[model samples]
Target: MVRAGARFMATGPAQSFLRRYGWRIDRALIKATKGHLSMSMVMPEVLLTHTGAKSGQQRSTPLTYFTDGGRVIVVASNYGGVRHPAWYHNVKANPRVTLTSRGYRGTFLGEEVLGDERDRLFELATQFMPNYAGYQKTTQGRRIPVVAFTEVR
Candidate 1:
């Protein structure tokens, strides 16, 4: 994670450039570190594995996450893009998922929070990542979804 005060967030255009390509770099670091470091100082991240909604193929994405009791919370921000991310659709199609983070692996089920609950989670997420507030502002009516990955017994 990029430290809060770090100059990780550059200017608008720079940030946009990073948003487009930084994931590949982060993914390599994550692989090398075995999830020990996600390369973002802003917040911790988890590598989420799920089946593709359309292709029915397995896919993985590294995403920043927040802890909530026994569940892990994640936002489908997609860097404030207009459309919901592909992973979001995959999670919706098949809630079952695997999360690898910090030398731990777990089986979990993804569920989207809605309405009041989503609002609460959004607020909580903004606390961890102030950038989320900006992401929300650009979204207008298209809400960035907040999802919880709960462990399965």
Candidate 2:
């Protein structure tokens, strides 16, 4: 079902719809289910709360995530768009964040991985969601960012 959804999401119109209002729907469903349900019903989904980069206001975004080596990984693919998502910029400016995923909720420090680490994580991300590779191809040379979020002790 998620694969089919991903394929649909790849369409120009679907992308536009998702870019506009998908997050709201995801948030509503998550809230209604108390975080037990996500739009991507199979893969782990996260609700990340971050401080806006420019506005310095609190913002939240729902994202697909996967656990690897005790770290939670999320791809800032922006659905293959040319620019990084707004959340990515916020996270870059303020690495501290709050996350709720897989029934766990806590503070985490988000770090954008680079070099071999990034390559490895991105590969793992692709395995978790194959559409990501296709998203990369559409990125024109913007090398999508992969972030690792670790619980703050």
Candidate 3:
């Protein structure tokens, strides 16, 4: 079921649909479930709250994520869109973020992974979600950005 959903979401129409409205739907569901659930239930999800790069207002985005030791890894694939997702810009502007995942909510520091470390994390992420490779292929050569969020204590 999860694989089917991933395949469906990788389609052009589904990608467009998700880019248009997936975040809003996922945000509500994640919040309502107190972070225990989301549209990508089996795929580990998180609600990332960040200060908007332009508006400065707080914005929340639900994203598929993977755990890397003590950090949470998320990709700004935007479903293979040519442009990076807005949240990526927000995180770049404000490294401080809040995340709600798997019934846990906390403040975190977001860092953009790069170079060999980025490559390693991306490979790990791809192993967890093979659809990411297809997403990368559709990206028209734009290397997707990966962000790691470490809980801020």
lDDT of each: 0.83, 0.87, 0.89
Report the Cα lDDT for candidate 2. 0.87
In the range 81-128, model 2's lDDT, one tens digit per residue, is 899999999999999999876566789999999999899989988876
Sum up the clashes in candidate 1: 6
Highest lDDT model number: 3
Q: Output the lDDT of residue 35, model 1.
A: 83
TM-score versus the correct structure, for each prediction? 0.89, 0.90, 0.93
Provide the lDDT at 58 for model 2: 91
Clashing pairs in 1: 1-40, 1-41, 2-40, 2-41, 2-42, 3-41
Q: Tell me how far the alpha carbon of residue 1 in candidate 3 is from the true structure, in angstroms, after superposition.
A: 5.5
- Global Cα RMSD, each model: 2.1, 1.7, 1.4
Residue lDDT tens for model 1, 1-153: 443522355358757766787777777777678788876755687999899999999988888898887789999988777888899999999999998888788899999999998898899888777777777777666789999999988
**Candidate 3 lDDT, 1-153, residue by residue in tens:** 667767777787877777888778999999999898888756788999999999999999999998898999999998878889999999999999999987999999999999999999999888777788888998899999999999989
